[model samples]
Target: MPDYKAPLRDVRFLIDEVFDFAGGYQALGATDASPDMVSAILEEGAKFCEQVLAPLNRSGDEEGCHFDNGVVTTPKGFKEAYAQYVEGGWNGVSADPEYGGQGLPPSLGLLVSEMIGASNCSWGMYPGLTRGAMAAIHAHGTAEQKNAYLPRMTAGTWTGTMCLTEPHCGTDLGIIKTRAVPNADGSYAISGTKIFISAGEHDMSENIIHLVLAKLPDAPAGTKGISLFIVPKFTLDAAGEAGARNAVSCGSIEHKMGIKASATCVMNFDGATGYLIGEANKGLACMFTMMNHARLGTGMQGLCLGETSYQGAVKYARDRLQMRALTGPKAPDKPADPIIVHPDVRRMLLTMKAFNEGNRALAYFTAQLLDVEHLAESAEEREQAANLLAFLTPICKAFMTETGLEATNLGMQVFGGHGFIREWGMEQLVRDCRIAPIYEGTNGIQALDLLGRKVLGSQGKLLMGFTKLVHKLCQEHAEHPQLKAQVAQLAALNKQWGELTQKVGMAAMKNPDEVGAAAVDYLMFSGYITLGYFWLRMALVAQQKLEAGNGEADFYQAKLATADFYFARLLPRAAAHKAAVEAGGESLMRLSAEQFAL
Candidate 1:
């Protein structure tokens, strides 16, 4: 079993030292949560995650969620664990206080998210999706809708899902066949088959509220005509309580590669009781409210999985005796020296550490931006914060997930074949982390969104703004000897990527094909650069703390070393992505229809 202790020191280092969440939240006056309050909440949340959810990880993956006769059953203990989760008031973190939420900063919610996700992603998805659903309703739904649904969702007696994908369509929501018809009672009747709906059907909650995207009868063709609807599994009575069972039913659940414990349902809504959310014929806009939240959360999942895997790997490496050191036998009297004595093994461990710590800093910083965008006093500040996150989200989601996959792979490598086996748990980490990049929109789509929408469409304003932030960080931390070289490297590379983005954007305007061809490559390059910046910031902080005479001198020193490994080994990946993007449309566009055929 993994040590599974909350990386409180590192978490604090990121929240306090790197991003300064308390100060950020205080600036917004969003919450009166003090340092002690934040510490107590994190500690208890970590305890719950480590004790209640961590143990279920392997069991959930092994047993998987079951679907029989239009009903889905989660792995054993999921319901009980979920009860504890709601009881702890976790579902309402950063939610509206008027609706029973804690009204905490998004940063604090992000902290809890990491703990729970690292402990058990499968169990985490249930509440995770519900909170996302609540956010969407709160943001876009009418006052009546909020009154009817927000309280129950905040309380976790009800769960929520985003129902967008169909059997034939995933990313191309414009072509979806789902339909919503208006009723005389002002409710819409939604009839659609939604596939891959996480938390769609589960026994953990009394009702499942689906934020569905469908087209009306007189709607125009494509995405513009679509509308967002809140379709509940059970109809609420006049008293606003879950009452009659609606027409929504789980057709089946997916047999997926990972996250098996979270129910992914194929839902059939035959005239399900539904209400419109936000404007008519603007479903995509409303769905973006939830999708963006899910995107960031998925990235955090990637980061958490990597963190736990690293912790597990470090614990195992120190205890398990392996081959003697290459330099000298550190434990000559014994049969073998611990693997930690070996330089190559140290490299693997360092790689995980560097990626995990950088990801933690990045995730929390992004969360702080979420608070700033919503609660910042000035309109200019809000716009800046929102734009910063807009460009950062795809990078956060794509980059963190991409690094997480690599980090977990390194963790598995550290354990040798033991990591490949089920009993050791590293294998499960890899499996769970793998899905993060694919879902919440594939990293490829994220890349296109970044280059096309985030970068090119806006004439690189958002991208440049984020680049300026990175430049400022580099310049501020320029005096830190340990990080100065890497900081310089990151700044130089970022400038190069920025220049390249401008050139590509200009050329892409003349040729539409170039944008699609370069999207993934551009996204991957940007992701690497973003993570490189994060690693540099973390390295600087680790170096400063190491000089401050911390008792955990060894840990801080190791953090600096890992940051070096990231810049040396991982950041080089940007070269390949850049090369591909610079290839322009020729290579990709040259492939004829017959070339792809047999």
Candidate 2:
């Protein structure tokens, strides 16, 4: 009834055929993640997503979450499902083995997470936050801190929350009012009120570990002064289990437009016992370790919702008997032909399909870079992957969400009247997805990070790291029989991407506002080109398979068709972005505050 199914076939296509994740895993010495193991995980992950998680998505949204006094209760079945998730060892698949994880590569974890998100994004938030928290502790926490938290957190008996935003600050961490004061016994007392803390308080786990950002007494003026703290809901006993209640409590939970089942809390930390992570005045850097992972995860939220939308729309389009096709009735046996007969409907369906599949390929490729960055032997290889990861991350977060939002809207459009209805479940997805662009360092901030910090800040070294790969792909496929034109289109766009960055970089030097003005459009241009590169590469693989008479001709043909649709329709949007970048910032900044009101 939920109409959600995991696209394991497509996952297999991306991992096996398109990205060669098997080879990638082996190359990275991830012998534990063999082809058989990967396949089994995919199959099992799909089953859990479809049977266990998908059914609860609608119920979770309708019931939302409950807050009583300071206690938060998730929607019915959420706790049970989480129990199954932890029991199945899904929590530790890609976490560190030292901390009870299976020590799998991070990319495989992402592949499973895609299924989890598609089936139940609201449910996914619980473990999702936990994983981000684990990464922060793993990277920056002390050995004692790791021993205290990582094992249980990875085991999923306890969960985690990233508490940074206050009622006052969302993006500006430097201006935070929360303060940390030293106590006699080497710990600190943290007092702060953090708002919009997802999974801030919940009943599903025994204890909650909060990674809070607060400034010390003698800290510097801005962001550099901020420090990271490990604040727990309940103090740990000698057994290291949750013992006495800490000073932290849920002040209230937000009544959100969506993801309501996941409690986004207003946490009140009244002089809670806290342990410092990394160093004093160095919390923001420590938090970025978690945020980068979150940004990628948040990007996949777009894909998850979009993929579900496509499945529902496709089913509806096939079964719903609408007006006869303009050409004629393809199904004359029925009173009217299905809307799938219509060109307009086909256009909508293809757009959703192309964006969903293309975005999947893009996410998968970027995910693999994580394994390379972490596990590769060569320092040069690791650095290259890291550079590419940094450059692509903002795009992954911003671009995927932007296009994915578009895809969800198109899914609703395909269903027409029914899309707005609750039972159809399309509208709920739109409501849920509405937040992805705004949160996780908003798409606008992501754009600025891409243009200002990652690209221009590196003096284009980081941008070149990615563009060189684009150039290589272009050169390799310059003469392909089927994809030559598409490759040429991609090649030209890749060249222009560099030129436009240089143009923006030059203008930004003259007027610092140029970066802000051109950032979103610049990022969009870059995203379009990035997805185009991936799509073109997918087309090449699909074409080669078709030529060689490989498995599932229909599947391969559909892939080629989607890639063609992407090139023909989606990639041209880059031109408009390029034009906007060239248009400069004058128009954007023209209206004085007083004049705007007049």
Candidate 3:
């Protein structure tokens, strides 16, 4: 039993004060997006998550997804919950109004996504995958495809999935063996076996659209030869109704350790009726449009998992009576003192809170940049915003996920032995958070993309631009007392990252092996610096609110304390990662074949 509350106050503070969502909405021509409307949406979403989703999390994990023969059944309450979820218009929170969407900001959708993930990540995947698929179709599909698919997808009548990973290939798409043949009827016949497809085949929606990657016959080798095809489980009639059953079938469902509620199907598309999306030879490029969004969404999973675990740990620590404090028992008359009385316990709880809050700020900050990149009017302004957002995307995905796992682990630690038990639900958070680093191109790949393509390719333009934003913020700290130390630490860390990034870039040219050797460490190091910047902004906001003697005094005070803990404990890890990167690539690559055999 975990009682989860969405952090609405903090969300509002970020929306109103930090980034000005109202201004963004107006600039994007969304005049209806008033603060009151946004608040109402979040309140309703919070209720659904806390009441409906949170209660079923443990039960769903216990029940798991049921696969009998070829049909897949989601955990109990999932079907009914999904119906209710769609009825509430939750699926299309940020979709285009022309296609049944509410036309809200993607930032609002992201905020709701955080709550959904916090309550039940397993359940969230069903809709999460659908959104990702919709992004692909909406971006690259033809007008007919948009009319037929986008509406239902927005309404959640049809769920969706991305079929990319196969048994032989997960990251390298060029060598994939799946084939797509052009049919005389202006469609393609797709034949492929896809593995690790989340929400690949589920008995929840009316139809499941799979945007699969397969190579056309007469195509070049590797990534350039791959093409994207929209293959549905049931073929649609001329009127866009479910027509006859298609050849697409589920071979089996993966029996995973976590997210047992969302079915991971091994899909087999045998001569399936398929339509081309975007250009035939340019499939990888089209799919990447969806992947960029997917990567960020996956990162949020870590944040959500961390938030849920933190709430559960806090509830348990307050209720569970245990040994007395080291200095003196806070509850002298009681039979046993609450675990919160111990300094060590406080440290564990504070660590989780600090990381979770910092991550929240990071998600919101990156989301605001997304708004600027998409909606800004001027080309100069848009390019500047896009550059900053692009630079932070990998950091947001890699760092949030890495720290999210750390925060969840801290949550488990706070519960001590109770966390390891199945009944407590702490172990589930740990398991669910573990996959974020592995998915959306393992964190190692993310690092190389950041250092090799984004940083070095631009000759440090993106990195330096981000540095300028930090400098501007630091200059603002002259008037604020609380953020002085945090700002200094961030400045130092950014300088180290800047110098190390330049060195890594230059070394990578001389020997490409050097990039692979230090990619993960560099990614993690940058993640720390970015999150530190977020915490500093949060501390500044919290300090301002507390000074006003607002009603949320305790909440604001807690925010400041957590910010201090992040600077002292978490931000320093980046320095060591930088040192490790500078130690030369030989430490990672110099081992002989015989030595590696052991």
Q: Pick the candidate with the highest TM-score.
A: 2
lDDT of 2 by residue, 1-598 (tens): 3478889889888898889998998889999999999988989999999999999999999999999999899999999999999999999999999999999999989999999999999999999999999999999999999999999999999999999999988999999999899999889999989999999999999999999999999999999899999999999999988999999999999999988788999999999999999999999889999999999999999899999999989999999998898888899899999888899999999988988887898899888999998899999999998999999999999988998899899999998988989988998888889899999899999999999999999999999998999999999879988889998999999899889988998998899999999999999999889888888888888889989987689998998888899899889999999999999999999999999889
- In model 2, the clashing pairs are none
- Candidate 1 error regions (>4 Å): 477-482, 548-551
Model 1: pairs clashing at backbone N, Cα or C within 3 Å: none
Candidate 3 regions with alpha-carbon error over 4 angstroms: none
How many steric overlaps does candidate 2 have?
0
Of the pair 1 and 3, which is ahead by lDDT?
1
TM-score of each: 0.97, 0.99, 0.97
lDDT of 1 by residue, 118-148 (tens): 9998999999998889889989888989999
Error of 3 at 179 (Å): 0.6
Off by over 4 Å in 2: none
lDDT of 3 by residue, 1-598 (tens): 4678887877787788767889888887767778788989989999999889988999999999888888999888989989999999999988988999998777888999999999989999999989989988988899999998999999999999999999988898788888999999999999989999999888899999999999899999888898999998899998898889999988898878788888888999899999999998899888887788888898898889988888888899887899887777778888788998888888888878877777888888878776666666788877987888788888878888888898889888888898998888899999888989898888888888898889888899999998877778877784566677778878777778788988987888899998888888888888888878878887888888788877778987877888888889878888789888998789777788899888
Query: How do the candidates rank by TM-score, highest first?
Result: 2, 3, 1
Of 1 and 2, the candidate ahead on TM-score is 2
Compute the lDDT for candidate 1: 0.87
